[model samples]
Target: MSRREKDQLHLARINFLNLIGQSNPSDAWKLFCLVTPNITEEQVDDQAETSSKLTLTTIPPDVVEMIVRTIDIESEKNVRLTAKYLKQIVDARDTMINRVHIHLCSQTVGIEVHEVTKEEPETYSFNVSVIPGVNHIDNAVKKFEEIISKPNTKINHLKIDWVRSEENRASYDELLKSLAVSLADFVEKVHVEELTIDVNAVEHLENLICSLKPDILKRLYVIGPPTCGNDKFDFSNIVILPQWKHLSAFTSSCCELICPIHHLYHISNLRIKMASTSPIDIVGYRDTLIVSQQRIDHEITISHDMENTKQMLEPYIDCSRLTTCRGYYIRSNEKRLTFELKHNKIIFSTMQFLM
Candidate 1:
């Protein structure tokens, strides 16, 4: 190494330490990179002379933590590559990723990462697309796990959308199954507060939802494929899982729930669409909520046309004298259940009362 280059490198290291503490994290890192351009681990460890290069190991761990915490993910990655000690420190620190969105459409997979801030949030988008006949689902998931699996990382919101179309419906269907299996294996490593997913298959949905950390997941939204006629999406396996039972609120895409209404009573708030509404099921669910002490609100929309309102309500109450778009309240004990019939929708909510 030349004497002049060594002196310049040493001066840059001294300036980096001085500026890092005085300037904001983003500015400090930018300046540090400008001064130490393309400095490899080998250069960092060079023992050419006594006063030449400065190794990051000489810096105290507390100072390293402070520097890392202020920088962005990209800077953190660069810092980790500098030395083994830096990598360990960076790996152990908790990084708060405010939100993540994963989208799978045909053959392309998109990943968006959002960082939390008081004002507008910062977003990073990554789209990974493979060739026509290769399996890209596995590769996409691996990239996703690399971010979420970081030690002590907490994600506030996570959303996954599987956009399936008719162009390659069969191929997408097979890919969806593969994606589900991969997600089921690694989803346990993620800690997210709220999740919104678009899944069409019951088995795939079950595997993904049931694998989440129940204690961390509070709200879950499921968007299933459109249904017609008597066909319904079966949630038989999901209602039994702890993740479903512990949710504070749940929203489902407009489709018939194959499971009975009572299976959803435990959730505090609910918005669901039923393929076909039966007076028996509506009355039974109403009766169950009225007698229970738990407080909840539910809005159920009947997707199919309801031509006869009288026939629908006859199982629970007399609706022969009632007109369309009427709001009715049924009170039993301390609970009051409001039932509104508007077109094909039934909006009913239970009131919370102090015991």
Candidate 2:
């Protein structure tokens, strides 16, 4: 601020405090308006409509933001309620908040707050008890909506954990619906992380998960038996099928799926608790053309050591269709890389792929 602004602000504070200490809120607000006389919102909109050319710097946006950031969170709402000028600051788009966690419970909604320190990852939690008529999720979302309406506000990570309660199934589902909708426009949606939940939301998770764009979803984990004796919840309906187009990874305790041959390009990993009990033929392309020096017919598999395995896979990658080292017949494709661990060697051949 310039010398004139600094002096005016100092004098305004002194006079404002005197009136406020005398228990005159109205006079204090009036004195505030006298000092920071602002043009009406209608006038701002009118100018924008009247002018086709307007650079971002036309308004000192940075300075306005710096002035608004001086208000503390606890007092921000009060300041908004007190004066029209302060309300504009609160309404400004760009949430200064960086992190938020919502914990959904049967009878309470808890918000987890992590401190600025990163060493121990210390966290503190505040909870709002569920009210009978009011929806917990809707109420919780109010804070988010108020801040996120700003064009620049970002929600870093939204971690929602649901503990199933039969008595609160309806409410739990409601919570999921609200969260899914509110986060529809969320940025940074592609972050991958393990998520474990068994709740009312599980019953229709497929639709909710599919509603988001392909890249918005991350790795997923589906645990069985979210509710008491409800172990029969169909994991296949939710995760095993190719529902969300390109979810990076999916793990389910109670479901197993024939890895989608055509959709392998979209999925990174599909693991089932029962997969070990069955043959693991992941990313197999029966008719896929093997691409090497030439377009040759071969199969592919995943391997940790593609270098050492290269000796075994050269014929396959080269479309030789025969293992030069072991003299074993091999089949392959350019679209699929198949890895097989046998006799301490990486093998790509199977009975079906052998010519």
Candidate 3:
């Protein structure tokens, strides 16, 4: 083995010694033999020297877990190949690792689904291009199916950026149906706290929303050009679950006009970007109720050409119970505007009361 590999093995043995609560020579030798291969007297002497040369420190498992969790899987794979002992450490702690991200360059499934634990929390994002030779849709579907069969696996968040070439664009509906069926099952298994989907294939936003299992969805963000010709996008067809509390949309002016904000009574954060001018009533029934409960927080971003700050601020001012309002606003160029409202009270002293 190389010098680096030898050093790693020595570190692993020291770590293993610390884990089993035996740091003395007698216990270390016994535990080392139990876990590692038998070694000669001369080899043991060399390993002891190597271990002594390095600073031996004991770290709590929770701290180690946090450190390991921060290392991306792809980077960990490189470290594992350095030595067998390191591989063991990674395998032992794989389940506690929470975040996993993969950037796809090839059309094939880059990762083996079986290698990862099902219950381990993971977030996945795919950046893929569908060229004549690259068939990402097929590969993606296969991976999706494999993940669904595992009972406890939950992908808390998923983002897909799909690009289709001019020559080899496939049927959008067929692809959507296949993906929907595969993901809808998994979506039902876990509470989908966040989801971001960007696709040029689907013409209507409602069609995309309809394809998902609606009951478990809490946050939905959609990004694409407007499909509906008018300012009002129709969301009447969608069944908004009571648990759904956040909605963000990036679309053309006409699409924002049709966005269904009235339907989302539970939503606390609503962000929308529109291309054209549209009248918005900020003090709607939902806002009034949320304000009463002290749960009001919202942001609305409109195109630069359509500026209506006074009109937009009218509803909030009218609904506010307090005479003074305190808030901050920052413009696109980093310019800031701040305001504060104050209240005054008067007190009478004993002498004043007597007079």
Whole-model Cα lDDT per candidate? 0.60, 0.43, 0.41
Candidate 1 vs. true structure, TM-score: 0.59
| Ranking 1 against 2 by lDDT, winner | 1
Task: Name the 10 consecutive residues with the lowest summed lDDT in model 3.
Answer: 345-354
- The candidate scoring highest on TM-score is 1
Specify the poorest-scoring 10-residue window by lDDT in model 2: 51-60
Better of 1 and 3 by lDDT: 1
Tens digit per residue, CA lDDT, model 1, 264-284: 777778887765543236666
Measured on C-alpha atoms, candidate 2 has an lDDT of 0.43
> For model 1, which pairs clash?
256-275
- Stretches off by above 4 angstroms in model 1 are 1-94, 117-134, 162-164, 168-175, 186-189, 228-232, 277-280, 292-295, 303-322, 325-335, 351-355
Model 3, runs deviating above 4 Å: 1-136, 164-174, 184-191, 201-215, 226-233, 239-257, 274-279, 285-295, 302-355
TM-score on alpha carbons, each prediction: 0.59, 0.41, 0.44
How close is each model in CA RMSD to the real structure? 12.4, 16.0, 14.4
Model 1 residue 134 CA deviation (Å) reads 6.1
